[model samples]
Target: MTPEGKALSNIVILGFGFMLMFTAFQTCGNIEQTVIKSLNNFTASGYTSMSIIYGVFSASNLVAPSVVAVVGPQLSMFFSGLLYSAYIAMFIQPRVWSFYTASVLVGFGAAVLWTAQGNVLAINSTDTTIGRNSGIFWALLQFSLFFGNLYIYLAWQGHDHISEKDRQTVFISLTVISLIGCFLFFLIRKPDPSEPTPSETSEAPLHTESTDSASVSGPPRRSLCTQALDAFVKACKLSVTKEMMLLCLPIMYTGLELTFYSGVYGTCIGAMTRFGHNAKGLIGISGILIGVGEILGGGVFGILNNNRLGRNPVVLLGLLIHYLAFYLIFLNIAPDAPQAPEEGTDLQAYMTPNVGVALFCSFLLGLGDSCFNTQLLSIIGFLYKEDSAPAFAVFKFIQSIMAAIAFSYSNVLQLPWQLLLLVVTGFMGTLSFFMAEWGVVAKRRDSDYDSI
Candidate 1:
């Protein structure tokens, strides 16, 4: 590819690759959650199994940077998708052991997938367009929720159970889609050797200081295990910085919210709604509502661009909106159970009246989520530039740990406690943005931002 063509192709490749992965990943993930619920997870309302998924996902990220370094981005992504497919296969026969095992495996793929994806996007996109591009990428990825959820709605419409034949076919289709993503990933051209990574670029904050300029000149001879451990320790030390820690807080809350959406929120939906596919199908629809919110939020942010509107204000607003959405969900939607049946009560009508409000709440959840998350990602990718790989790794590591905790407590915790998570976490997350003095530049590092 020509220089211009190759750059454009990079954009197209990421868009296409992520489209494939997101489609397969969300569909299968939703299916797995549905299948698990149907089987009756008497063990902590199935939150334990979900926690295992996030926990393993957290552990896998410890080596994700190393995997990305050794295998390169394309191969790392391919293997990541493959692992996701393996985890999806577990849905066919959901058991406690198998389900938890699959969760662990899925976490493995998630670490690699996200780590590589963030770096690829950061390298390929410019600071000027990073905000818009992040928004676009988020919109495209979330779009999968729309299609995947729609499929679930159709497949299990009006029924609380899926037939064996349908189940097999659905899973097989997801696996195939994942395979397609791998192929598309393989088509992506390598990052141009001419491009400077964040570490080489002056824009990135200092990560590791040079002790002796000429002492360490080449790649270390240590194994991947040693490299990962060294990376972990470095990340921990760096995490203590005001900017890093501040960023980590909100990012960690992002994980908490993600856990809630992935496990707790859906579980709550099942509890409140008594219709169609053990409320699994309904949760799928909720996914679509969230997609709508993300798309709209992304559109607005993409239009504004972080440099012009100032990233912090937008993020703070998003935090407020997010907290409001969850508060509404806690108050009007979550605790209200399906009303007792009257004579000849329509089974389908159970809690149907409240669904509109619930769907609205779901949209706000996505909007608020997309709003802050998009900015955080764009800012981090822009400020850290080439150092994005490890920067994001630390972000993901902290985020996943918090998410695991939230999921672990999902069933055991009371509604008030859950709301406290939203309240306090949201407050701290919003506050973290103030603590961070990020350099928001349109193209190059602005003179004013030299302080960052």
Candidate 2:
């Protein structure tokens, strides 16, 4: 392939790999329906078994990054793909143990894919372009998942049609996609030599200082591990300045709100179904709105940040909108429950006030929640140049961890508790206010440093 073709191919392959892995990881979004169906075909223990399966997957994210750091990105992707394939293959058995085991493997593999993709993109793109590239990558992956879920939902149609055999088929197809991704990874050329190696780029400033004659007369040799360790230590020791803290607040708030929305959305769906509402279309519409929101938020934020509008005000405004959306969800829509039947009847009822509230809440949540991460990522790109990948990775990891916990708690808990979880999450938005303020101050410090 020509250089351009090679680059394009790399992006395509990597992007597809990311999409497949993400689909596998996020298939949990369908778990409520899947578990409900599994109970009818299998023994009563199926629900608990499914929970165990999901919980294992959630726990895996905590360790996936550490694994990726030790294993090279290519190996990480390969190993992850292999594990995903194995997991899907095992789904044919439909045993509880098989489900749990498959979930763990899929989770581990997905973490590897996630970390590797970010590293690859960072290596390939410049700072100015990285946010846009990342946004596009994220958006595409999400779009793939949206369609994947739709396909599954349409195929299954009603809960009765989702047999173990059918579930196996679904996973088998996913495995094939993963295998294709793994094969494509081999075709991906190594990072361009013109681009800095991960180690060199991550520790460029230190390496430059060590080599400079004014700083050190001789070639100051240091082990890569030592340099990496020093870089990490420096990153950690760099106390969260008032500016840094302020900058992080908006992101953190959005992160918290995101977790809440994810948790509440599922519960709201169940609630709507219980209240005799057709929520399927509403759910799909919410997904599209979220995609649109992300595109708008990331694209506009990137352009504005690149031009003149500073990151803080834009992010702050997004946060405020997010906060309002959450308030609307909690106060206006989410509190209503299905009214008790006036007369015992065999016939099913139609839409309830609760369902209407849920649909509206979902739309608003999608609008507000979509922009949080995109805006935060763009801001991070604006803040640290060399450290962007690692920093963003760490931030994403934190969000994943928190989101996993929120999901787990939502799954286990009952109604008011779930709502309470969301309410608490809304309060977390307060943190974003400080993060925005911090970013404003940090820009000044950055300017002063540049002047020096």
Best by lDDT: 1
Flag regions of model 1 displaced more than 4 Å. 1-5, 40-45, 194-234, 273-280, 334-353, 438-446, 449-452
Question: How many clashes does the backbone of model 1 have?
Answer: 3
Mind giving the per-residue lDDT tens digits that candidate 2 earns over 1-452? 44334444565667667666545534434333333334444442322433344344335544444444444456667777787677656655556566666665565565556555555555445555555655555555554446555555555443333466666677777667657767666655654446554433663433233123234453334443554454444344322644345444444445445545443454345444443423433444444444455545544554565554545456456656665655555543333221111111122223223545555655556545545555565555445545533444445544555555554554445444545554555445445544554655576779889999
Residue-wise lDDT of candidate 1 within 1-452, one digit each (tens)?
Answer: 55435644765677677777777776665455445444544232345666776787788777776666545566677778887777666666555676677778878888888877776667666766677778777777777667777777677666555566777777777777767877787666544446644332531212111112134453454654565565555556555755677787788788888876655554455445433333555767777887788878877886566545577777787888887877666665434222111111133321343666766877888888887778777777766665666667777878888888887776567555676777788888877765673523333456657767
Please give the distance, in angstroms, between residue 284's alpha carbon in candidate 1 and its true position after superposition. Answer: 2.3
In model 2, the worst 10-residue window by lDDT is 337-346
Q: How much lDDT does candidate 1 score?
A: 0.65
Model 2 residue 314 CA deviation (Å) reads 4.3
User: For residue 73, what is the lDDT in candidate 2?
Assistant: 56
How does candidate 2 score on lDDT?
0.50
